[model samples]
Target: MKDIEVNELKERLDNNEEFVFIDVREEYEYEDDNLGAWNIPLAQLPYKLKELESHIDEEIVIHCRTGARSGNAKQFLENKGFKKVRNVLGGIVAYRNLEEEE
Candidate 1:
């Protein structure tokens, strides 16, 4: 699977590009901080797959506190036939670090 850097993801969001930015962390972790992502915890991903049916073929960027959960999520989506799935390397921690550097 492909991986996206934090800066690239930020640029896409800044440009208002259409893509699915999924937060795979639990609710509390998400409440701590998130990059303007859709609330879809990893636990609920299977049940919520239908909700994202339309985006199956779209660019999907999955993230969590670390990259672990999102990595699993990305694999799951790929197994289910998602065309373009990616994990944001190092997850939000990396993203936050990038933001701090800028």
Candidate 2:
């Protein structure tokens, strides 16, 4: 699976690039903080697959609190035939850290 760093993602967001950003963390975590991604927890992904059908060929980035869950989510989406799925390396924690540094 492909992996994207926090900085690159931030650049993409800043550029207003069109892509599907998914937060695979739980609802509470999402409520606490997020990068404006769609809330689709990893556990609920299978059931929500249909909702993402239109985005199968689109650029999809998945992230959680850490990289592990999003890595698994990347594999799962690939198994389900998603064409352009990527995991955010180091996930939201890394993203927040990068933002702080900036």
Candidate 3:
């Protein structure tokens, strides 16, 4: 699976690049903070696959609190035939840290 760093993702967003961003963390975690991504927790991924079928060929970024869960999500989407799935390295934690640093 491909890995995307927080800085790179921020740059892409700043550039207004089109991509599907999915947050694989729990609802409460996302409620606290997020990257304005679609909330589809890891446990709900399988059942929600259909909702993302049209994005199978699009650039899709998956993230959780940390990279682990999103790594799994990347693999799962790949297995399901997604062509451009990427896991946000260090996930939201790193993203937030980068924001703080900036």
Candidate 4:
């Protein structure tokens, strides 16, 4: 695992950079607030692998409420032969703080 700080993640979004951004938080959590990322809860990730097969070799960024879940997601994808998986450091908490700072 490689990790991306929330600030860098923010920059990527601002620039409209192309990458697979997956929100591993629950639907309810995502419904509350999110980065408009494709929602795939952490527990459901195994079942969603086929849909993500196309992005196996692409850069995949995962984030959760904090960082733990997304860190697990990063490792899970990596173990599944999906390289370039990055966990958002400090996750959405830090991301939200970035907006507060602005």
The prediction achieving the highest lDDT against the true structure is 4
Question: Model 4: residues >4 Å from true position, as ranges?
Answer: none
By lDDT: ranked, best first: 4, 2, 3, 1
RMSD (Cα, Å) of model 1: 1.0
Please write out the lDDT profile of model 2 over residues 1-102, one tens digit for every residue: 468999999999999999999999999999999999999999999999899999999999999998899999999999999989999999999999999999
- Give per-residue lDDT, candidate 4, residue 55: 95
Q: Report the candidate with higher TM-score, 3 versus 4.
A: 4
Tens digits of per-residue lDDT for model 1 on 34-61?
A: 7789989998999998888989778999
Error of 3 at 93 (Å): 0.5
Q: What lDDT score belongs to each candidate, Candidate 1 first?
A: 0.90, 0.93, 0.93, 0.94
Report the C-alpha lDDT of model 4 over 26-91, residue by residue, as the tens digit.
999999999989999999999999999999989999999999999999999999999899999999
Per-candidate TM-score against the hidden true structure: 0.94, 0.96, 0.96, 0.97
Looking at model 2, the pairs that clash are none
* Native-referenced Cα lDDT, model 3: 0.93
> How far in Å is the alpha carbon of 15 misplaced in model 4?
0.5
Cα-based lDDT at residue 29, candidate 2: 97
RMSD of each: 1.0, 0.8, 0.9, 0.7
What value of lDDT does candidate 4 attain over all alpha carbons?
A: 0.94
- The worst-scoring run of ten residues by lDDT in candidate 2 lies at 1-10
